[model samples]
Target: MNKSARFRQSIDFIEEHLYEDIPLEQAAQAGYTSLMQLYRDFYTYTGHSVKEYIRKRRLSGALGLIKTSQLPLAEIAYSCGYSSQQALCKYVKSATRMTPLAYQKSETCYFFPRFDSETIRQVTVTSETIPRTIQLKFYYPKQRGIEHQAVAALRTLLPEYEGRIFGRDGEPREGLFCYELAVEYDPEVLNRLAGSLGQELTEVPEFCSTFAKTAVRSDESEIGLAWDYLYLKWLRTSMFVQDDGRYFEEYLCKGGEVKKLLLYLPVRKRMDYDKISVICCADSKFLVSSREGEQAEEEASAAVLKVLSRHHPELIRTAREWYVARNGMIYTCGVRLEQAIELPADSGAEVLLAAAGRYAVLESSSCSDREAFTALLDAWIQENGWSKEDLPAFTTYETGGQAEPDAITMRVWIRLKDVKNG
Candidate 1:
């Protein structure tokens, strides 16, 4: 019944089934609370949440086994609840910036058990070398709407890759997974997988003409690395550098087991602005700084979100978390401050709602992108002539004086006005 007792019960559950499949719901049941509540309280009592604690505990034992045995990575990974060895490498890299074998190679492998009794035993440590994490150069088109038709178009033009894709690997990834579709001529592949399609139907709906995309996978570490290879090392050296523009991954839902997704630099194909709004967030701090070879700021955004969720779960329970690869972290942004006006009036009773109502907001990215885009949105608003609704709450930051760090904030507000009337 008490918080302390519930925690002890949950910890006991973890201890008894250390090797068992520990889902969050199951762990929460031990404390007789909902999964979200369990997560909040557990993380409240322990710096680590339930899943994190379990992962560390498992990784601890995994290190022990690695040092004590010569088992392969798959075995080590499966034994520790990782879906694949690649997934294991992903998690390790996210936390420690190394792979199982690389960590072993650097001789930084140590198994420190949380329970005191296990530390008494002396064990011999062994090490090994590991292959580097491979970078995948995935190509896609810019238009989400034109994706499927473009894929069908590519098949029509390139007769070799026509019906089936690459060595008959079945369908090239379908719509749900396809980020963008591209076409480019590959001299190497011209002799390889080139052919004609059903020929262009001029009378048919206009499909933006495309070059056959030369999407290839190779081992590299970062996107910048891919650019260096493609531009500096390979581009000028190769005879014809012309290719169709590519729409690489601009957004990610959950990057899953990826470190850096390889991308072809976006170049203009038809000499025009693609009618697409780059949906960016309030701050480009992490994403922009990454280009300067800087790590993302000590990310408290999510931590702050956690605190917000703890206090205002309802507003953020349905919150979206976007995986921005360049930044190398999940951005669990609360709703746009301007969206607050859409909420039911009763929502204001909650801490977040009240906070949202009072916050002075700014859409940092909306400001950063071509000013015309925001102007476009404002133009639409002006054209509609609907100005009575107040601007919504937005999460914004401020600086009172130069004496202290700038406030990393959560509440911001927006004001909607009729330009013609005002």
Candidate 2:
């Protein structure tokens, strides 16, 4: 078999038998290769050692169950192939700073995005939320090109105010590239900077944000891609909408083998807008598990594993989770390509096509946090002056490339009807 097929086979085997005590030899056999070859290929493709990958996947699985299901911790641990609930707890606390019980009690979902590539930059993206902050911002026009001079002057004059630098292109003023160099404001520092450096204090209101840190020098050049990826891809589908506020990048440590940058964009959980984009989704096959109620369809999604074990063995490890809500009924599912061998024909599987119309799309995980979804909906409806139609909402999953686990992006679309006029 080709390299792609081998990797798929290996992943499929691992995912299939994740609940079982799978040996390396068994995984290799599933991939139709020697253990050594499987080891090398798995590492190359996933940037994770076979053992590490299995552990992380299992932990992720355990987390999902812990967060979404009524299942007991011991049951979750056993189902995720852990020796005991204590083992699961130890790993959970080690990886995330919270215990399983603590995590479950909290309103936050611990399902952060995962990275799967070795060549790409190794940057960690984490959610940053602060209630209220005030900053003194200094502006320099692009034409003057005095940003460095301004920064240098401020650094020299106030030496203690080593603030962050922010850049903006064509906003508030046309054809002007401006930098909003900011320092966490102290009345004393603000007074000193204004008197000495002559920069103004700009009010940056309370908001939630995201922060990215570049881990290695090799990952430095790729940091720009990470920034673009977050802004272009992540923000669109996220619960938060970009507010009319400051967006900036801060250099944490300069001229070091290990570099760090904190990119900040001011965001509100949602905004009201009556405008909607009419989208046309192609007809596709979905391996679905049916569910009731408005909760995230994680329980129903389990059906995907069963379908994979039977019908489309190739996609067992490869497909990302998906969801389709018809007439408000949720179906936890994943998309299947047409070329893949068709099975589940008699298994009550369904084909879905999202009807084209005006839709308000929120990009989130297939199994998204319920609170976040509710907040987004409330804010969106209020802001848009638009109300939902009778049509069903659908969540679509795109991995962006071939079968890479961490490449998933889930988008939920709510159909809107009739714009309210002011």
Candidate 3:
């Protein structure tokens, strides 16, 4: 069977035995894989370990029974695989900060539903980084036909200048709602435009740093459907929760007509992480050279580039390196390769394997403070109930078609600890 189908089979086994004791080995056997592989595949696919997934499903099932049936709490707990009513109560209270009786009396429910291959296939979600920008906001009161009024105002005002535009729905204040139309321009230019239009300009130093984005066509009559799908459907099933940042839409306008737009929903990790995604790297080879001491990274990179230029100059653009702290500092520089190649015996290079696995990734536009970036990622990993694997973490450098230092960016990838062992 295919990997996804086998993964679904394992999920089916979990659902079938949720109310019973399920041995980890048995669960792995259901998918025809070893326990370690099963753990890796489960976390990669569902963003949750098998044990955690089962615990959450049981909790959700118990909550459903409490709301609909008049069964005793002890019986409900027993059926949900909890040893005692007290144990179930403790779980509920820890997750929802409410006692079981209190939760039943109130209207609140904590539910983490089951996920299968079909559900994963249907849901489309992606992470995005929103750059810092300046904006001029226009607000409109909440009422029927306010959307039309906002659009008319935008059509009237857009002809004054040209730049990126965005729209957002704001919170209500004193029974009045707000619809903001944002234009990306310099503060000085936006100040002039605001003056001509008799509106005040608001300079936003930082936009939403991270967002969950989806594309939507402007031809859709009601954009509310997209929002509904994102919040009501996708949010409930995904490993992300809504963040405090404002949600907005980026308009792709042509001749004052919006042909399409991107809907950006501010989101943080449902768990302790910020914005986390999984990446699988293929097993590859790298031509590597290592150095140690102060300025080791720069010296190593320059040394590798010098070697590559003498031997294989065309591979410089594909350069990357790993930074490790040994006695003081150590940096290994190289170009990754998809296949093995013969090298000169005198060349100062060694072959290193970049092992294949699912890695948790974090990216930064600035590589100046790598320690700060790594510290943040390490805290996120531990807080989100994950451990770092005993693998070398690495950074990749990419150029933005410029030789300037500001044009280079870095991304960090660290392997996650195996769930079965963690």
Candidate 4:
């Protein structure tokens, strides 16, 4: 609902010098942004170019000046940052599609993001996206006697909850029990858990960990239709959903506090070409309503491909096709068999495969059914300044691969380069 600090800074400069010939160099210097970096950062967040923004602002101002002042058109143009009226009129027509005088005679003005209070939508501008440090961790199974003790231990950490812990009733799968721990993001919780576990738990074997900046989007929908859109953006573009990606939604003003819902996307993966897999899966219907899942599945691939075509469409120059498969929680992206471009053979692929980005990690709310989780993902998209353009092309895979659908976990993986960008 509001702009980021950088965008605000840009606007501050724009507002103060609207009538001046402010170039990209000046704005970048004022904000300490490199030219290329500034372009991507500004466009990604605001969805507009700096010059385009200035042009819009000028058009909006020119009409006001014409309406109320006796200033000459040339003077008005100069005051609005145009070096000459001819140049000004050309841009005005480019924007309004009519001469300035002609448009003024018709008493026209410019408006963007026109919407009512209830239906308001916001475009987010991110601060310079910097890498965050976090531990990439995995959880191994505990001994039989420790299972009960672990449950009791967890209760101490998350007490007063009515829901049953997964696998508490029956034998859970073996291996490490994946517990996401972060001292930086959740220092209090981490410190508390560490103290509670004490020296006795220090010997527990842990997985790997790393620090990286991840994308954090928040949405809530009865069906994960919106989440599908966000995924659509991710695949289509060279975007990253970092291991430590976080999500949170604000519900009210501080004094009149409102509910806040937050979720973290755990990632700290390396794109090892040798370990990377070109194929992965996701279940679309798991989060989205059956109808919505079907609708999203229909366009699932369109989502990711859009990004691929937009940025590295050249990747597709060899294999000009894409595909996605998902039923509820699982969605898979792969190339058509006929369009087999070179899959990586480097050691990096192996590393990538081991990392979270290597597989086709599909998200499902294991705690709830597909409908509930899908709806939740949708709400995230709306609140988090996300749109389909932000996600990858998505296609629903067929369901029931001889596995219990409910037991299926939510996972997705892509190459490190497919995601990690500033």
Candidate 5:
């Protein structure tokens, strides 16, 4: 199996046996790798060591049971691999700064949908205008490997995040649901120091905001519940109201069984979509296959595979695929340029510059048929009263970006008119 698949296997093993004692050897064996190798790669991929990840997961799991069930604390502790109730309480306090009794009381007194209200440490309210932020746009769907691009962006733009992620969920751009993962930097300083990078800029107006962090895993419904609480409960009770502006979620680390997500929702005293500044795309390097015509699809596939085999055979790790339309034709196979290097001439692979500008994006899985995909995009564009722009459309593969042509998933991007000034 490929590295991504192997890593998934290892994570699956850990999640399955989370309530039990898991040794490093077992996890390594699950991945078909060595202890040291798994240890190193695990940290690189998940931003947490095996031991640390397991501990946090166990605590979170135990806390969930404690809040929902009538089971005694001792039983919950033992079931969650804790030695005793006392041990569970100690661990909980250390992690969340709350005792079991206190946590339970808070849960009883108040709640935030799927999450316990007490677990919410604090919701800091701020009413400052958000400065211009730089973000890399990419697609995130209910699939694998797409997140790698986001991680790559974080590493390139914000090294401080390490492998951790901080992102703003964006509405569908083009025909895909695109996310703008912000680069942590002062926009003014970046513009002053390197104004060229400002092409990736987006600005937000002043608004009232509530911020909270939770040990909730990304896969859980509680994450959505937290958002719902901010909107349904917190915002409903406060004087502030949600505007058309986008809310943000900062992921401290990539999702596994343990993730600390800082959720933020900036509410406005009044709606101000017009007051908000429009954000444009940043310049990007794209490695695209150029084949167009009656046989373009077949020819493009062969060309992309040829390029990969010659220059980047290592990228053939997964079956992810991507495509985009341009000049009345399609580029059958695609990947962001930074993911690959050392392109050989006449191999059907060329580096193209993608200009910074507005675009509509939409996410589609490999499983969807062409008609369904197109229909979805059509509905979204029409409903939102959006129009296509004069720029070329594109897509990026979610998998290794090279594989058998049929096994790929992709995100499509269509250019949009510069509506910010309009």
Candidate 6:
């Protein structure tokens, strides 16, 4: 097996024996690697020693049982590979600063999810340049129930059009988001068909910049997951940075069913250097939680938005979102506010100090990919010779930018250590 496969095998072995005594040598033997090499691999990839990984995994499993089941503490401890209930309590307190009983009553919990290698192989990203083409653009308001309208329009147009169709979810403009369906058609042919079609036909200029492209199923869930992995995981480690160009999808329809599409993201070579300003805030309020599962962050964000809409409607337009990730799992998500406001007792919000410090900020007109923006900001921090602080980072959406009227700018903030000087 290759390196990733070997590491995956070792991880599988460790996971299978998480509730049992897992020796470092046995885990290494499962992957046909030496114990020393296994230690290095775990640290390099997962940022945890093998022993630490096992311990955290055990704690995570035990905590799940603690919060959900009424099992006795001693039984829970033994089932999760703990020697006794006292040992489990000691580690839980050290990690979360809460006793098991107290933690069960708390609103938040820390969970370290398993590492899956299959995610790395799910989507393959390649670089390409798309030539200039003619496109039919469809504009729509940025509101609910617009997706069905767009899909209906595409269904009507796809049967008649014989060329390639591309879809783009454009940046917000005057409280509107454009959903353009482009087709490769001859100018003369489009001229005759433009009048019959209600939408505008525009000639897209040639794009010389390179783009990162990946193939994905056209289903909504798969597309969302692909984008999440791209922005949240891949971009942080990539050598290229996201460019200031629109991303789009090339649809592949068969038998009246759209099955797959090519997702394209504009990218450019990483600059040798870049600098950003730091914004400081005093305090903020948030509705926060550390949960598990693939949709945990999305669900938490939606809940925060719902509460804000009900209690603080005025702040909904410019609300900020934050997340906390440890050991490659994003375990926390919620809304953050810079302004101090008293929430009603039923608001379900908590106060979190927005510690005053220097931060690296990356502003983008497109708020669809906050994770990618944060990844770019992280790359900037590394390129500009700044160290990141152990603080929660966030992205704030500010409306009305200089670029356009009603334009929304997403500012990603990552706290930094003091600047190093020669």
Model 6 per-residue lDDT at 44: 46
Greater lDDT among 4 and 6 belongs to: 6
Per-residue C-alpha lDDT of model 4 across residues 154-260, encoded as one tens digit per residue: 55664543321221112234554543222122344345456454222222232333221122232235113433333333211212334443432112112222122
lDDT of 3 by residue, 126-153 (tens): 4554544445444556455554466567
- Each model's lDDT comes to 0.38, 0.56, 0.65, 0.39, 0.56, 0.65
Runs off by more than 4 Å, candidate 4: 1-3, 112-422
lDDT by residue (207-251, candidate 1, tens digit) is 242221222233233433444544433222121233454334321
Determine which window of 10 residues in candidate 3 has minimal summed lDDT. 116-125
What is the TM-score (0 to 1) of candidate 4? Answer: 0.30
- Which candidate number maximizes TM-score? 6
RMSD to native, candidate 1? 23.8
| TM-score (all chains, Cα) for each model | 0.26, 0.34, 0.38, 0.30, 0.29, 0.43
Greater-lDDT candidate between 1 and 6: 6
Question: Worst lDDT window (10 residues) for model 4?
Answer: 113-122
RMSD of each: 23.8, 19.4, 20.5, 19.2, 23.9, 16.4
In angstroms, the error of model 6 at 353 is 9.5
Candidate 5 lDDT over 1-422, as tens digits, reads 77767767778888888888788788889989989877765434443456766776687567666655789999999999998889999987765566887876542211111111221223444444443444556665532333445555445544443333457655665565566666445654345424332234554333344322223346436677777656545443233455565677666664232256667665554221100011357977656677878888677768777777777877655434445554655545555555547765666677777777866555433433343334444444443445666565565556533344445445556666765223
User: Which residue pairs clash within candidate 2?
Assistant: 237-363, 272-383, 272-384, 273-383, 273-384, 274-384
